[model samples]
Target: MTPLLDVRELVVRYGDFTAVDRVSFPVGAGETLALNGPSGCGKSSTALAVLQLRRPDAGEVLFEGRELTTLTERELRPIRPRMQPVFQDPYGSLSPRHRIRDAVAEPLKVQGRWNDTDGPTRVAELLDRVGLDPSYGDRHPHELSGGQCQRAGIARALASEPRLLVLDEPVSALDPSVRAGVLNLLADLQDDLGLGYLFICHDRAVVRHFADRAIEMREGRVTSG
Candidate 1:
């Protein structure tokens, strides 16, 4: 079978600076592909390019055989829910004003799902899926611990039933004490939901424990893993 997500010869630049050079990889169902690199190695750029949130200077971002790089934002709208992101800073990514349920429900609302009979039910299920109590939906970001906030973020991402998750340092911001729990939750989610993951991180230890396969980058190019 074709890979669920493929980045072939991907290149990105900032004016004269080339941030990602000919990077390529594939992520299959329920598998983890870790893109490991130090700061400024373009790992984040590659992740965003795959999602078409960042434009690539040249390359192919193939999601289930569709060429994403050529799609306009309007054209890419439907594809967005299929590939969601969980960023490093959970608190910053979420709206301080919105309660947890609303945050998770927003994606469904964006897709015109608010009127669906099971919209509320789905939100509850997603919160449960991410290991958060469904009752916590009433809480705001400040009311939750960092781990709880990240779990809520993941719940929000999963609200769309995403098949591939672009986790950009997903566990990096949480307390080290809680990192293992969050990573374990991600692992469980992959198994339970059959989700593919493109994990961008700088930690080798994390990769060793979390990823099914790994690639390393340095100075804007794939080095080794």
Candidate 2:
């Protein structure tokens, strides 16, 4: 069977600097493929390239059988919703000015799936699905704890009904006490949705506990798996 996401000889460069080089990997449905490495190891760059947020300098990003690198922005728009990102720094990922409800609702609106009648309900459901109380939607990012903010971000990602999630150090900033809760929530979501995860994390312990398989990187190249 085909994988949900496949990256072949991916390379990302900036002027004289190369951030990711000749990296290849595949994430299968319901599997968590962790990109494990320290800072400046090209994990985040790979994630961005896979999402096409920053197109790779060379190589192919195949998502559900489509090559994303060759697609124009217009052609990529519809495909974007099926693969979402959950970034590190929970608070930084969300806009402080917007209520959580509006943040979650924006994806629906952008995807042309929003209706005044069911939109609010859907947002509430997403919040609840991620372990947030629906009423918490009225609050802004500043009103939430790190863990709660991350949950809110996950809710926003879920709003897109994504099949794959590129999780970039998702719990690194959270308090240790709450990290397990958030990780457990993610595992539950993956189990329930059969979602493929490109989980980028520097913590080996976390990666061992959370990821089904891990690929280690150093300086932009895949060192081992």
Candidate 3:
């Protein structure tokens, strides 16, 4: 069966520096593939390249069967909705001005569901789906705790009905005590939504807990998995 995301000998460079070198991996449907390594090991670079946020110097970042590397912005727009990211800082990811509900609803609106009669209901459902109370939808990012903010970020990412989530240091910013809940929430999400994850992190312990399989990187190359 075709994998949901396939990274084939991907090479990403920054002038004199090679951020990612011929890295290859496959994330099957509903699986968590952890990219584990120390800082500057190219794990994050690989994730960004897959999202087409960074253009790779060589190789392919294939989604399902589509070659994303060469897709124009116009060509990539439709596919973008199927892949979403949750970054390191939940507070930085959310807008201070927008309420949680508005933030979650933005994706749906952009996807042309703006006029749908069930828009509000759908937003509420996503909030609940991410383990946030529907009432929290009225709150701003500032009013929520780190865990709650992260949950809201997850809710926003799911608003697009993405099949894969590029979770880059998802639980790192939260308190250690709350980390388990957030991680458990992610596990539950994968089971319920059948979501594939490109889980990037520096901590091997967290990766062991969250990911089904992992690959190690060093100096922009895959060292082991």
- Top candidate when judged by TM-score against the true structure: 2
Kindly provide the TM-score of model 1 when superposed on the true structure, using C-alpha atoms: 0.97
Task: Report the C-alpha lDDT of model 2 over 99-176, residue by residue, as the tens digit.
Answer: 999999999999899999999999999999999999999999999999999999999999999999999999999989
Candidate 1 residue pairs in backbone clash: none
**Which residue pairs clash in candidate 3?**
none
lDDT of each: 0.93, 0.96, 0.94
Backbone clashes, candidate 1: 0
In the predicted model 2, the residue pairs found to clash are none
- Candidate 2, position 89, lDDT: 92
Alpha-carbon deviation at 165 in model 1, angstroms: 0.3
Candidate 3 deviant stretches above 4 angstroms: none
Cα lDDT tens digits for candidate 3, 128-155? 9888889999999999999999999999
Residue 133 lDDT, candidate 1, scale 0-100 = 83
Per-residue lDDT for 1-225 in model 1, tens only? 999998999999999999999998889989999999899999999998898888999999999889999998899999999999999998998999999999999998999877668888999999998888899999999999999999999999988889999999998888888999999999999998999999999999999999999999999999995
Indicate the TM-score of model 3: 0.98
Off by over 4 Å in 2: none
Residue 69 shift from truth in candidate 2, angstroms = 0.5
| Root-mean-square deviation (CA) per prediction | 1.0, 0.6, 0.9
TM-score of each: 0.97, 0.99, 0.98
